[model samples]
Target chain A: MTLPRRGPWRIVFVAALVVAAVIFVIPFVWLVSASLREPGYVFSTGLLPLPFHPENYREAFQAVPLPLWLFNSAVVGTAAAVSVTLSSAWVAFGFAYFRFPGRDLLFGLVLATMMLPFAVTMIPTYLIWSELKLTDTQVPLWAGNLFGSAFYIFLLRQFLLSLPRELFEAARVDGASYPALFWRVAFPLIRPALLVVLVFEFKASWTDLVKPLIYLRDESLFTLPRGLKVVLDRFGVRRRAGLAHRARGQRHRHDPDDHRVLPRPAPLHRRHRDHGPQGLSRARSGPCGRRGRWPSGSPRPAPPWSSGSGP
Target chain B: MAAPRRRPTLARREARWGVLFLAPWLVGFLVFYAGPMVASLWLSFTDYDIVNPPRFVGLDNYRQMLADPMVARSLRNTVYYTVLHVPLTMAISLGLALLLNRVGRLSGFFRTVFYLPVMTPAVAVGILFLLLLNTQDGLVNGFLGWFGIDGPSWTTDPAWVMPGIVLMSLWSLGSTVVIYLAALQNVPRELHEAATVDGAGSWQRFRSVTLPMISGALFFTLIVNTIAALQMFTEVYTMFFGNQSTQQRFDADASTFYVIYLFQQAFQFLHMGFASALAWLLFLVILVITVVQLRLSKRWVYYESEES
Candidate 1:
């Protein structure tokens, strides 16, 4: 019974690996093939033998101002990542080093905050930004995440906790000040975790859609996901209208300028939503009345995400 | 070198410096995290449309949640995802980690290759899958055809949608494999050697020694994986709703994950109270599962301290 295994198990393991590779690769292969397939051929293309179309990417490019959106995403993602990392790491140092009153309680609350739904804060946070007059700017888009972000703080604290307390004791026995000790001792030890946090923050912020959508009303400020949304929504309406017009067959009878059927997205090619004066026509940035506030000004009276009476 | 601080002022200054170090995190938690959490609990008791002022509604949100059919469906979907994904991840990661533990070549490179998926932006992954799983031009069905087994339209069919989510999850099991590999390296060679002397095969040694030795790591992974699965938002958000075309989907109900459903109710429909209730219930579910796992782990998880 066992002799068979020496031969078959090796074959079996190889077969299993082959099966696993198929599982991982098949879906991804299909996606690249589909994304490259043109919209016209999209419906008709059979799976394996279909001709590869590089033009679908061109169509996708034509469909959206992907370059600008990509740029905006990079900026926003990087800003959030850097800000969150520095703040979180600095804050985590405090939690890790100090024996403060309410530290445990505060840490518990931070962990508990991880459970808080974004919806509960959505209105209040929006209202705060509105009140502060920062609604349309990239300032609001960057929306400096505080140092005490529970998740990152906890992560850094855990890393710090794993360090030998004797190291801290040894530093204190010497001439090192607390700040110098943290900077000199703790920071070096937790470099790995800090690097992880930066990557995590970048990925989280870059892929995020809802935050930018709420805070940044300016078309120039749209992140990749928001920019992507505008394209998808606009193109969808256009495709629908275009389809209808095609169905009607060259009817010059319809009002040519009527935009009710065709939805035009903000022209992504320009820094402004549209270079044509019609696009920049100032609109109320919604009920968020005081929308011009930036951090470059005095410390804003209200929290960035809260409409609560100013602190 | 220097001496200990001579003055009371210096000791006091050191204490103050420590406080200053912690102050940023402290202020952020109280203002952003704690404030919102308490606000959410309060909002759970009120009828909030977000735009309109919230009104006191007592337990109406919780009552409505009890009556909500979608809550049950979402809960079922979540439990199914957690149950299926956790064991599958464990099995796959362990298998891969074991295979690579004694590998002859490029161990570090293979480890990095596995972890690449975990680092990928989840939305990009979703988009990537969307392209691949396109019913018509998708590569999956093309391979299926080779096997003489036709796969269903993965995203289109309700039966296949959750499976798609699960498969997407399994592909990212590299993180778990890395952790498992780290644990595997520490398995006492003495135990494997002792078992080897007793005529034990690789399978027997793994069962009696490796499994028991790594039970703590297994426990930790289970709780973390459960929490990750329960809080799964980005994948479902991108896959089903966030990146959804405005076109009507095949099974509208099937597309929503439990967490995503809660997000929609609160954000899209402005049912903040109901959403809070859903969040609170999820918190309880996670807490209960965590407690149960911890209790069970006491029996099987051997602390190194115990043997010492």
Candidate 2:
């Protein structure tokens, strides 16, 4: 299509795009704003953060085991990405370059496996891992990638199919080992597909919540998403009417709803003190104010009732 | 290109190399995927808790699933979500792609901006959107307030929870948009020019020339988005009830998706047998839907190279 040559239509087109972009970006902008703001200003509606506290990130780090969680996420993500990419490329090359019996059938089988959803195999797979004492470890999460994934293999095979077969033949004739031919010739030619596999596998591992939720028991072993869940559950406001009711200044001071929204900073800080140096600060800037739940007066959470104690 | 040198020994060795290369994946399939598939099928017919040996129950688990209210609710919720989500996502992604395709110079910049959402971790997106869709101080409600419209309590209200999740799901339209963009760019410009010369207007040219070329991508995104919507978990899980506490509970009734219920049955409740039956049912549903989609694609999906 021709450009509209600086007409009003062009301006309208650009303006519409800008609006869409802003709408897409507002969540991220809110995350950044909420993360940076002082605990008191979290309920503020304005976009630009007032009394910006970059220290909340430091406190966020202190509040939870952020470093450990980040580290675990990296390890699993990298392992899955690297293993999936290499194995998928290796398997794809075998299918693409070699003229073997059952090659088409085997590749078809690989594609067919993609149809089976994870839930179908999830329970038995977990049992197998548990039986092998692999549960509660990071192994189960990334080990599946050691055997080439069906989707990645299919993707790489399609890419390999497009490349001239001559490259592999030429490399083979040059006295190169079969493995060497794959590594030197086929692997380099399929770099884009490999990169795609790497990114896909990394992101899949990084954001996976179910596998970790099932496999991991130890809090120390949790990944970022798991840790984030812990933080949200611990600090998030729960009542359905909390945010809206509080916003209108109609909230009763002694109501149970009030306790769910307000963060009792001193007690929370004291609790965090046992965990780490910055736990208190983390609690102060936690999911409470980010929720914009309460306008005032912090309510203390009731202590858990002891067994055999009557209400 | 190398010459077709058919050395007898080398050809024989190539077959050996091929099997050797396939061995890793083959072993993986047997041990991980194939083995578990069989095991789960067996497990579905029995009462199995993780701690004890599985006992044969002879379709009891499946029978129980038929009676379970949550199973029906979950299925209804999943179907509702998939029905709403897949079509809306297709429309939005296609619209974005068409918009990006028309804007010449800044398309690259806008494309990057649009694609940014897909790169953010899904868990992070969930949490971010949870806050963004809050009833009172959320950016969404704040925007709605500008027009004097009171936004529903998105996060907490059972009625609005799935809609909130669906809106959040739209943020990850980047990958679909990219696929559509690639397909859009591939539509033969000659077809457009010819149609224009034939006095076809822009909409008519697009309908007759552009859409047919991109039908393959449309078919692909449809199948993918449907399958994905059926498995909706992380976003809804994070937004409504986190994993920390009440990990067993499907808090908001409307947001209890099929996969999430399956997950709770297997892990939280330790009803592995029942969950397996639920899973097999899900498998059948997906298989049927996919087969139906593939069948339906013959009607609308245009392949440029196919002989009529």
Best prediction by TM-score: 2
Quantify all predictions' global Cα lDDT against the true fold.
Answer: 0.63, 0.75
Model 1: residues with Cα > 4 Å off, grouped in runs: A1-30, A37-52, A99-144, A155-193, A213-219, A226-311, B1-7, B242-247
Best by DockQ: 2
True contacts kept of each: 0.23, 0.48
Estimate, for each residue in B1-308, the C-alpha lDDT of model 2 and write its tens digit: 24555566677888998999999999999988899999999999987756456788887777677766778899999998898899999999998888788777787888888899988877678777766776766788898999999998786666887788888999888889989988988887778778888999988987878888899999999999999899888887766543322222224567789998787667654667878999999999999999999999999999978956
As a whole number from 0 to 100, the lDDT of residue A52 in candidate 1 is 55
What is candidate 1's CA lDDT for residue B174?
81
Clashes of each: 10, 0
Q: A7-99 in candidate 1: lDDT tens per residue? A: 655566545555555565554454554445433333233444245556556656565566777898898888887887778878777777776
